[model samples]
Target chain A: MLLTDLVQELGLTPLTPQLPLDEAAGIERAYVSDLLSDVMGNAPGDGVLITVQVHANVVAVASLAAQKAIIFAMNRRPDENTCLKAAEEGIHLFSSSLPAFEIAGMLYRNGVRSLKE
Target chain B: MQLSTIISALGARVFVNHNSDTCEIDHIFAGDRMSDLLGAVSEQMLIVTHLSNQGMIRLIELMDASAICLLNGTPPCPELQEAAENAGTPLIVSPFGMYESCGIIYSLFKEDTSSL
Candidate 1:
């Protein structure tokens, strides 16, 4: 699904509004994890990440994992510096009131799949 | 789902079995971060993670999780095994990677809910 479509469908609030959402980039898969190591090793490239981690290191790991966007579940938001770094790295950041599991389920029902699928 | 069913589904080896054959798991929380696991874990949740350490054993004890399944065939260290044995927590080693392990368990969950 398109990043914009996801944001609208999930009612996610953009953290880095300065960076425009990519129209051509479609997220086909998503990985839900708060572990940076797991995300780095297992997350699909160019896919979305659903996590509750708000630390600055999330940006570095997401960038390394080649994630196009990150949705921080449970209304968790990173600091301004982290958001700035994510924007600089071209990774979109969003916040949602729903928890990670619910977010993952919603995405799954909407045709997003796990990496193996 | 029973812990035994999950072990068989993943072709996992049981290193520390504590009534896992009949133990029922109602949820699956797959992650490597303890902090995330702490917040997400619910009753009868089976934790599927790549981390095999004393911390994991402690988490199982603290949260009273049904079981802990380590992925990628990674064996738990002697200390971790001892901890699990002492705490009576089931420890399993899955031959598949994290993604595949979660996928298999997710399919089981989907089937379970579909039947309801």
Candidate 2:
């Protein structure tokens, strides 16, 4: 499904939406972890990342993997300058108050399976 | 998804503006050890870690990832920031602890995934 479709379904309005990352950028798949290296080594193409470690390096890794988007969970958020950087890079970012397991379960139920699969 | 949207979603604060390095993200890899990030390459991905050392900045430069998202509200130091600025690395700082931050991200991804 399209990313927009998923957004509409979730009834989520991006708190800091920026430039688009389309062109068949499918984030339907997910790679959930707090290990930057793990994701760099294992995550598949078009996988949306879910993590708690917020750093500029995250963008570097994502850029290499060619990910679909990034989600910062647990009510965590980035700073002002970081947000603008994301906009310029065109990396889609999101935040939530939920945990990894719950979020994973939700995505699993919706066909957004794990990289392990 | 665009990194700005993640910033918005998490209500996060930013430290650096994304440069020509490309801000688009699709994958997330969180870790503090630079060694683990050695071979893994997720184009346009995000690296979630607490390490704000200059080495990390250099790694990002070598890796060419999308941006960095720091956990526990920890941001880069002046040295790291300067390095990031010089290298043109994008960065974000979050308030939640590591585990909780991971969960929150998963939640949002699932939110959109479930609909599909």
Candidate 3:
């Protein structure tokens, strides 16, 4: 499914339009993480981000590493500065109320692939 | 659905990226151990953990994840916030335990129907 469609279907919030839902290409799977070190050491650039750390640094880190979108779990809202940073970076920020696993489960049901064996 | 709904649904607390409540998400992942996450490879994934440290920011940058979720209602450490701001990656906090949070997210978002 398209990113926009998925967003609407799942009832999520976007911090910015940087991640164009229409531009769905190369995004073959989903990866979730909370540790920055782990992400840097292992994660690929072809997936999305579902986390709860609300800060501008997350934006910079995600952008630098090249992530599709950043999804906030547990309804973690971002501050003004983080929003501005996300806007500047053009990074897509998404929020969900379904905790972390629930959100992941939903995406998996929606046909989103995973890296876990 | 608006990103705000997702946040509300997941019961996550937004420390930053409030304006990003309109952003869209496709998938998610959960883990606190940096080594476990780093060892795996995937696309368009979000991370869930309880460890709030600046180093986590660097790891997020390296993986290029969609976002990071601090589990167990733990707030982001000062250094983590700084790194998040600089990195421009959205961060969130969840009150639910890691296991429960993952279950909720998976049931609501996971695509594996047969498994369910």
lDDT of 1 by residue, B58-88 (tens): 7866776768888778788888788778778
Off by over 4 Å in 2: A1-117, B19-22, B114-116
User: Candidate 3, after superposition: displacement of residue B97 in Å?
Assistant: 18
lDDT of each: 0.81, 0.64, 0.65
lDDT of 2: 0.64
After best superposition, candidate 3 residue B23: deviation in angstroms? 39
lDDT of 3 by residue, A1-117 (tens): 567866887798876755566775544455566656555544457567777667557877777667767778777878878877877776678888755566666666666664433
Q: Which stretches of candidate 1 lie over 4 Å from their true place?
A: A8-11, A98-117, B39-42, B96-100, B114-116
Model 1 chain B: which ten-residue window has the lowest total lDDT?
B107-116
Over A69-88, each residue of candidate 2 has an lDDT whose tens digit, in order, gives: 77775555767677677666
Clashing pairs in 1: none
Q: Candidate 2 on B3-91: residue-level lDDT in tens?
A: 77667766667887766234776666555556655444577767776677777768866776667777657767887677667667787
Order of quality (lDDT) = 1, 3, 2
